[model samples]
Target: MKRIKWVLGLSLVGVLAVSGTAYALGSGASGMMGQTPQFIRTQNQVGISKMGYGYGMMGNYASSNGAAGYGGNGGGCGGVNNGESYSMMGGPYNAASLGINLTDGQVTTDDQALSLAKAYVQVLNQDLSIDEIHEFNDSYEVELNESKTSNKAFEFLIYKNGGYISSEMGPNAMWNTQYGHMNGRNSGNPGKPTVTAEQASKTAQDYVNQQMGTGYSIEQPEVAPGYYEFMILKDGKDFAELDINGYAGQVWFENWHGPMIKTINNGSTTK
Candidate 1:
C-alpha cells in the first residue's frame, strides 16, 4: 500500500504577493528558508466548461475492477509519452503496452480527470483540494491545495485514456525532502543543503545550455522541499520546465507536459 504525506505546520496560510499569485509559507522545522515557498495558490478560479477545451463532463465511471486507482493498471505510476512507457527517471521502461482500455465515451476529460484525482487523493487520506489542471497531449497534471486554506499541496499525473495516476516525477518525487513518495511520506526536517539557490540556477542553466544549446533562459527558481524549479524560456515564453536536486545537483527536464492545450483553475470548486 502506498503512503500519503500528511503535511504539518502548513495550516497557517499567509499571503505571498508574486505577479498577483497567492502563495503561503508552511511553518515549522520542515519549512524551507525564504518567502518563495512550496505552498502556492493561484487566484484564477475559472470554470472548466467555460475554458472550452471541448471536453465537458464525461460520465460517472465506476470501476469495480479497481484498475482506475492510483498505480493501478500494472504501470506502477509510470507515464506514457509518445506511446511509450517512461520511467520516472526519464527513460524508456519497456515495450509493453500501458494496459489502458480506451473504450468509447470513456476518454478522460478535465472533469473526469479531476474526479479521478479527487478519489485517488481521498484514498491517501490527505485533506487536499484540486487547485488547477493542465491538459497535455497524453495526461492531465492535477495540482492540489490544502482545502479551504488554498495553500499548494502537491501534484499528480492522470493518464488521459486509462486511469493511471501517480505522483509527478523529478522534483515532486526525487527532491521532495520532507514528504511524499521519495520520503516514504515520512515527516522530517531535511536541513538546508550545501547547494545554494543561485548555484542550482546556474546548474540548470549550464545543463540546459549544454543539452538544449543556447538561446534558452532560466526563470526565477521556486523553492520546494529539497529542490529548486525553474521555467526554461525560449523567446521569453515557456519552452520547458526543469528541476535541480538541492543536494546532488542533478537536473531533470519535464517531458510529460506535451504541448499543453488547455488549463482550468479551481476545478474542485465546480460541481
Candidate 2:
C-alpha cells in the first residue's frame, strides 16, 4: 500500500458556486459540533433490508437479507461511543433534545457551522483545524487538519438545521482501517492489502453497476489504510463518492452527502 502524504503548501483557493448557492470558501474558518447517529443501510445482492444504529468501527452484523456489513467508527475526536441520538431513525437528524431550535426557514451558514466544529474539536482536546468545507443538500461536511503539521485529520458532517455534527461514515471513519476511530484514536496497523488501486477501482465500478444504473464511471482510487475511496462520475463530473474495503472488498457508499452544492478549501492552520 502506498502512503498518502498531504502537501502543506498546496495553493487551494476559491468558493465554488453550485446549485445557485455561492459559498465563501477559505481555510481560516471557525469550528463544528453535533451528534447525529447514523442508521446505516447494509445492502444485499438485490436490495436493502434492516437498518441499525452503527456505532464504533468494530463488530460484524448480518443484514436482514443475510449480507455481512461493518458498522461505522463511533467515537472519534469527540464523538459518541454509545450510539446516542434523539431518533432511532438512521441518517442525519436534528437534536431538539440538545436545545437546538428548529425555527422554520432557518439555515446554518458556513461561518456558524465552522464555529461549532471548532468548539467541538476543542472539547475533544484534539489539536485540529478546518481544512475544507463541502456543502451538501442537508449538511456541510467539514474536513479537519492536524494543527501542527497541517495534514488532513478527519471529516465530519454538520446538519444545516441545527449544526449537529458526527463522524463521516465512509472512508474517513470505517474504511480507514488503520487510523480509523474503531480501533481508537490513531490505533490499528492493518498494513497494506493485496488488492491494488486498479483492482479496487474495478470492484467499486461493479458495485456501482449493481446498485445504480449505467452511464456511471469510477475514478482513480484514493488509497486509505484499509479501504479505497473512489469518485463516481457521470459525464465527467463528480456524482457520488464511496469506499471499498481493501481486505473484504465490501462497498460502503457515502449516502449522507445528498448533493454537493459547493466545495471550500479553507487552507488555514490552527495553533
Candidate 3:
C-alpha cells in the first residue's frame, strides 16, 4: 500500500477577450451572480449518477500526486483501491477485510466497488465534458489506509483539478490528518476547516485588485494593465484577457478551486 499526497497550485495562465454578448461555456450562469442562462441541463434529466462512496472522507479528499504509502491505482483511464491502499472511494481495507465486519448481505467486492466508482466518473465526464473531467484527474487520488483497523481516509488538494493546479492542500484534508492529529494525539483546538463564502469573495476581489489595480471599474478601466489578465463580466456576460500577470511567462490557475474569476499570464501581450 502506498500513501498518496495531493497538492494543488495556481500556475496556469489564460487570456480571453471580453465579448459583451453572453456565451454559454457549459458553465451555465452559475459563474454569474444571478440570471440563469437560457440553456439549462437539469441533473435528473441528464441522468448523471453519483460516483464512488459518498462518505465525506473520500469525496472531500483524494490525493493527486505520485507518492508512496497511499495512492490510487489507475485502470481504464480511471482509478481504484487495493488492500490497505487509498483511493477516491475511501477504504483502508480491501473487500475481503471489509466483508468480515459486515452481515451476509451488507458487504461488497472490490470489483463491485471499482465498477461503481467508474460509473460515477462516466456521468461526471458527460456533464462537465471530458476536458474538465481529465482536468480533475490531476488533483484527486483514492487509496487505502495502512493501518488494518482504520477506515480509509482522503487527502484533498485545494485546487479543482488536482494538486498540480493549486500549491495549497485543501483545508479539509489538512485538518483531519496532519493538523488535527499530532504525534497520534488529538490536538485540543483543531480549528474548523471550511472556506467561508465571504473569504472566497474577498480572495477573488484581492486577486483582481492586486494584479489589475484598484478603482478600475469592471465596466470601464483607465488603462488595462498589459501584465495582468482579467475576466471582465457585464450584465451576466463575461470574457477574459491574457497577460494579467505582466506576461513575462505563463501561469496556470487550474488550481483556483472556487468559483471566483481567474487571470493567467501567457507571455508579453503588451509593448
Best by TM-score: 2
Instruction: For residues 87-163, write the lDDT of model 2, one tens digit per residue.
Output: 11132333343334445523456555556556556655677777667676666677676789765566666666555
CA deviation > 4 Å runs, candidate 3: 1-169, 176-196, 208-271
For candidate 1, the per-residue lDDT at 110 reads 57
How far is each candidate from the true structure, as Cα RMSD in Å? 18.4, 14.8, 21.0
* lDDT scores in order: 0.48, 0.48, 0.23
2 or 3, which is superior by lDDT? 2
Candidate 3 local accuracy as lDDT?
A: 0.23
Give candidate 2 misplaced runs (Cα > 4 Å). 1-60, 63-107, 114-129, 145-152, 183-187, 267-271
Candidate 1 similarity to native, TM-score:
0.51
